[model samples]
Target: MSGDPADEQLVRQAQGGSRAAFDMLVLKYQRRVERLLSRSVRDPADVADLCQETFLAAYRALPGFRGESAFYTWLYRIAVNIAKRHRARQRPLESLEDGEGTFGTDAAPSDDATPEALLANRQLVRGLDEAVQALAEDQRRALLLREVDGLSYDEIADLMDCPPGTVRSRIFRARESLSARLRPLLEGRGGRRW
Candidate 1:
């Protein structure tokens, strides 16, 4: 039963049949859940639905929650599971090589950029996406949770169910791998690293 005292208190209230307490938790984390789901689910409507589904499932399972992890961590797992299932039913994950979307740098090119510059930017983004996709699952997850989600190492460790040292190591390895893979692309562009 270790977590934020506020969340722990809320959980106890919810477990004791307090719907308002549960609603407060939902209000607090709904945006975060939506953000997490949006990473995998492209459709805004689908993301909204999945967010609702996640909360519904969490509410039903509240009684059984033993506070092994932080409430948000547990909720995060539920959101992730819901998103994964939604993705599996929709389509295979989009790929960088598909040329339909960019993963890392979503910024559109400046208005005055030449066609070649736009093409190069696209290539750089594609390269980063490919490099990221090539990482081992654990490394990829750790890196994304840290870099993209802005989660602290300790928070990532809690979500990942590993030590903070392991989270740091995984992020380090993932970054090293990305740098190695992207070195050629970066060097080709005047040695600038994005």
Candidate 2:
């Protein structure tokens, strides 16, 4: 009903056990929370559970919020920790898929093409995927958050607990690495190009 209601007021109301206030907060943060989790989570479906857990934790700690940092910062920290922990817990069974066998002999994902174009596309994706995989973890995370999850640099910084400058640097490095890695594909030198 007003021009941009304040988040602090909403938070205070939520903290006081106002379900409507909490719902508003949830609606405001839902997309961001999902994006933050999706940046690292392989299975997007699993993001729902993680988002809930993050919010649950936030709700529990809401009263303790000192406002030392913005609410989104605090929420971002919770989301990142939850995502990182979830990633860590699944790490033993999960790997970056090293070696030729994991990616197949082609070194890429299947192409969206047919017949003559099919093999070429697959090689393209493979080369691109490998290039992305080769990036350093921090760079890869930033790049993935942007390219895959479609998050803004500010959102990425929040999720990574870093400054926007750092996020930009990582993404730049990642794009460079990926471009170099995929260069062969672009030139049709790696496998096939037309």
Candidate 3:
């Protein structure tokens, strides 16, 4: 028997009506889901509420999971969907005088962005691009495939003609490099808030 139970095993146990198994899965993924939600939702309270909702939705849909993808990947999709719905519902209300009011005004910018925020955002994007470009070619490719394209390690390995273990290592190193480059600029500014 395996020394450590895989997520697949926990998923199977959860699907077999084991509440403790499901709780284990929840504990493992809660922080990841919260971080994902934080990217979209600015309010901590709303993030917590949405995190709970995502897990609840996942639990209800657990029986239907077919294992075509990793459980975390499946759970990630559910969390994303929940965050999208929460954002849609929490969209800012428009004034009567604003003739072009629309549901997704958040994306369209109902008002002008402050100069400071705009400059900070632009700098952040530039730094991110520079950091990614600075990575070794293999590391850059692996990071883009896994992060930007959302490809699984196995899929990235097939495309890159490398082993999955190598792909994992490349992505990890790429992230560490980028983080080191970006940390100074992001300090004391509530980095994720932007």
Candidate 4:
């Protein structure tokens, strides 16, 4: 983590239109922005667009930024907003019944699926991952904030600029969606599904 003083210095330079300083800021926060975008916008291409939008918005808004929130907190807020806009502007995913396949990024398939019918297990895991990617934007956001970023509900609420209760509910809904989608795969002896 950058020390408070270093953060403040960068913030000031970014606000003053120091391109290198702003680029550094973007580098520092890119992963968080990418994660935020991934949860809100399932397509890797869309996520990339949102990440760019997040940084651009942050650059525009930096001059007026108050230190009331941590810099990262504020930056995340921009990413969330950018992702929301992207989701809103784009057509949503077709339903599971509609034959769309895959969600989020994939790791190369491994034999972690059922030993008996490895291909079937791989398909099952892939389906569940798609279901997670197909989650509602708010639910995906909250779940990723908790699971991926390891943020507290309150902290998530702050980043989301919503109430903690809302954050908790989104998390619950997201988990339900994931669990329901993954139950079949999890039922097997292998036990765990990533």
Question: Against the true structure, whose TM-score is highest?
Answer: 1
List model 3 lDDT by residue over 1-194, tens digit each.
21125888999899999999999999998987887676456666998999999999999999999876667767777887898788778765322223211111223322677878766655666667667657896897688767755778987776566689999999988888988888877884665422
TM-score of 4: 0.72
Q: What lDDT tens digits, residue by residue, belong to model 1 across residues 1-194? A: 87789999999999999999999999999998987776566667988999999999999999899998999999999998888788778766556433533264567778899999888888887888778778997898899888888999999999988999999999999999998899998887887655
Which portions of model 2 miss their true places by more than 4 Å? Answer: 1-5, 91-114, 146-159, 189-194
Clashes of each: 0, 2, 0, 0
How many clashes in candidate 4? 0
Candidate 4 regions with alpha-carbon error over 4 angstroms? 1-5, 95-105, 109-117, 130-137, 162-169, 190-194
Candidate 4 C-alpha lDDT tens digits along 1-194: 23257777888887777999888888888987787666545566777877888888888888889777778888877786676677678786653433333342244556564466665555675676577677886787678778878999988887788999999999888888888787777777366645
Candidate lDDT (C-alpha), each: 0.85, 0.74, 0.74, 0.73
lDDT of 2 by residue, 43-156 (tens): 657899999999999999998987666677788789988988998788543333432311334534355545667666556656766676567878887887787677799877
TM-score of every candidate relative to the true structure:
0.82, 0.69, 0.51, 0.72
lDDT of 2: 0.74
Number of backbone clashes in candidate 3: 0
TM-score of 1: 0.82
So what's the TM-score on candidate 3? 0.51
Number of the top lDDT candidate: 1
Which residue pairs in candidate 3 have backbone atoms (N, alpha carbon, C) closer than 3 angstroms, thus clashing?
none
Q: RMSD (Cα, Å) of candidate 3? A: 11.5
Worst 10 residues of 2 by lDDT: 94-103
